[model samples]
Target: MQPNKIKIKNYQLNSNLMLAPMAGITDTVLRSIVRSMDKDCLLVTEMLSSEALVNNPNAKILESNENESPLAFQLSGHKPHIMAKAAKIIENKADFIDINMGCPVKKVVCGGDGSALMKTPQLASDIVKAIKDHVNKPVTVKFRLGWTLDTKNFVEFGKLMEESGADAITLHARTRSQMYADKADWAEISKLVNEVKIPIYANGDITNIKNAIECLNLSKANGLAIGRGALGNPFLFKQLEHYFNTGEILPEQSLKEKIETLKEHLNCEIAHRGEENGIKFFRKFYPYYIKGIRGGGAYRGKLVTEDNYNNIINLLDEIIENEQKILHIHSAN
Candidate 1:
């Protein structure tokens, strides 16, 4: 598989794979884990509200590790001036500044932000232009196909973004009304790619190397911006890297390896977010790591509610022991 080099402004990213910015999930700890897996894969910070960041520049979400470079700091807002100001504040810290125009959450849309911007192309273009004028780093926009099926204007939107000085664009390939419910229309991404000259990264429903290859073949995208698919699978980026570079698929992580990685992820979260909140925050991830294992549902049920760190560790250890026993039994038979 031939790879694409994502070029924005003067920066040329080593790999085309991007760890898409996910609200509340792509924090320092998660980025650290993904970074450890593939050093060159692009990492994005969770969406930051321009107003909130302007008011509180020292917010914890702004905190980042040293190695998470080639990182894009994503901002969500409608006001061009405020968005540009926020970009200015983080420009020194970020390799690229990304604007979030694809989020479909009602709270965000009601504020004329996120997917709401898709309906207001003029304003979205202004936001891009403003950020471009203020920051030396590359400016990118992430958006959906449109607000609804009747208004799937992504091709026009992509051209407008390019005219307004957007260095790149990421298409989520779904109408705002869909809200992640149905399949993403990769055909729309193909349309956008045909219309825009700036690199367009396809972003939706890509979970593995197979999906990655299918998406690239279908959309002709320069790269992939993966979000939810990477939730508990930190090794995904490296796996994709290996396949792309060598045309060889790496074996999936064994049960023991998954358990040990989960333990490391937990400890990192605890160190970054402190014990109580970290343990609680980690609940959202237990199901992803234990997804296909036998007795996983029951373990996930207990893990989500268990706030005691030691107990969580013990339960994880128990899972490994049980899996070993099951393997032994199967071998004997």
Candidate 2:
């Protein structure tokens, strides 16, 4: 069943299916796209560096709008004061401020941020407390199971954050060492759920409504935070909402529907970033949108290399024309 309204202190979210803050993927443009599909799901901005927000103070990462309401700004940094400063900067703009402690990239961890913070509970605790002190917005933390298998300190780490005044927790159920190698350990989330009073969200590898249900059942979490799953499948949020409320699996989107949406996605990016840079950034999303089309492989290769927005629009026109031929013939059955 769908969860009722989830309240994070003063902020209330209608859907428990939260968007995970990805570094480059969940930019303002993508968030804007997700918002058009889902009015209730909580959205998260891409991970921002605390140092950048403090040094430049005009970083584009801080860009947002009320259209993506209940959005959270995720900050990554090691120092308590710098993180605190970054939190304060986005306090008025975001519904809540989320600290990222689960990023597994070597560059991020080596900087004593992301998952490396799991190894230093004291510092992680201080960073949370520091940010809480600087902002009136509810504070949240997204971290992994632990630094490594040998250092499985998630229960202890979660407790530390809870004591440090984190309003919510999102646990990606793998250690930093696990990275994306294996499946998320939902059982571990159960351990933290039992130990903390704050709203704990289960993240990592949750792709569908079934996965969300199983993860919630196993972890007993307040909600599920989806990241990679929502990349080209923003409809997953809507489908999940539908299934949770009715237990009916909605029909998969037709190829024509997907192609049209991809075209819309391209235009949205172009509008946000202009033709040149928008087309460049959008090249990565071709595979996600065109994955199942009959000639998707060759088209993906062609689309990614193309530079002009007009060419992209033409190619999309060609794809839609071909796809609709098969779609209409099949529907007539």
Candidate 3:
């Protein structure tokens, strides 16, 4: 219930919340929007390959806005030296360098990266120590419970990461085998918190203030890392910050406000990707923006397939109209 500032080595975060690094989702535009809502919350970049950075320092994924500081660049790889090199290359651009060991995607794990690292603790430890040797920035590691239910070595892993010089650890309370299917095991995070000297952030299933409170109470983690829950409602960072500081829950944004925010997101997407590709990229976000609205499922279907930008705007307008009518009817009832 108390607001806590997260101190990662010498870096101090004004807020204990962090935007989890999500591949393909946590790009420059999304980070910028989240920052507009909550300036102090730590923002992280989408996971990038160490190999890609070593091969090309000017990777497009590295592009970021000037305002997105206190940002952490997440790197995914198993090799020690290459990962350290990548970390050094981006040292000036990042407040922290995050190592990815929890991603469960087949393409990533198959190459001895992501959740696969949990199975090789020594190598994972080496990667952390290597990065520490290269960059003076705080080094953090994000990982899941373990490879499977039978292999829930998060407590051991957390200690190892701390010993290997990880300044902080973020634990998504699910095993690699779970693949987000079952409820995250916050109890496991509690175990890790007991074992690690570094700050531990509890992640997974923390979509709202109530969930945040519960996870913190159960895990006693120093902070939280929000991922999928932030998709449609980038306002979450502000909402969480408000609750943590004042203990007053900010009401969720009205339908009209959500639509306006969606428009802003769309405009940014279009500007970044250009008309055609931007509109296409924006399609994937319709469901999150229109979620819970009356008849949103149908509207989402139409919006995703609609290529014309003007048509999409008209469809959003219609959704807002329908939602207002539905709300009015419910009030009368």
The model with the greatest TM-score is 1
Q: What is the lDDT of residue 125 in candidate 1?
A: 94
Pick the lDDT winner: 3
Q: Which scores higher on TM-score, 1 or 3?
A: 1
Please give, for residues 96-198, the per-residue lDDT of candidate 1 as tens digits. 9999999999999999999999889999999999998898989989999998999888888889999999998889988999999898877668888887788
**Could you tell me which 10 consecutive residues in candidate 2 have the lowest summed lDDT?**
1-10
**Scored by CA lDDT, what does every candidate get?**
0.91, 0.87, 0.91
Candidate 3 Cα RMSD after full superposition onto the native fold (Å): 1.3
What is the full ranking by TM-score, best candidate first? 1, 3, 2
Task: Output the lDDT of residue 117, model 3.
Answer: 98
Per-residue lDDT of model 3, residues 1-333, tens digit only: 675799999898898999999988898999999999999888999999999999999987898877998899999999999999999999999989999999999999999999999999999999999999988999999999999999889888889899999999999999999998989888768887777778888999999989999999998899999998899998988999999998899999998999999999999988988999889888888899889887878898899999999999998888888888888999999
For model 1, how big is the CA root-mean-square deviation?
Answer: 0.9
TM of each candidate vs. truth: 0.98, 0.96, 0.97
For model 2, the stretches where C-alpha displacement exceeds 4 angstroms are 328-333
Give the clashing residue pairs of candidate 2, or none.
none
Error of 3 at 77 (Å): 0.6
Model 3: residues with Cα > 4 Å off, grouped in runs: 328-333
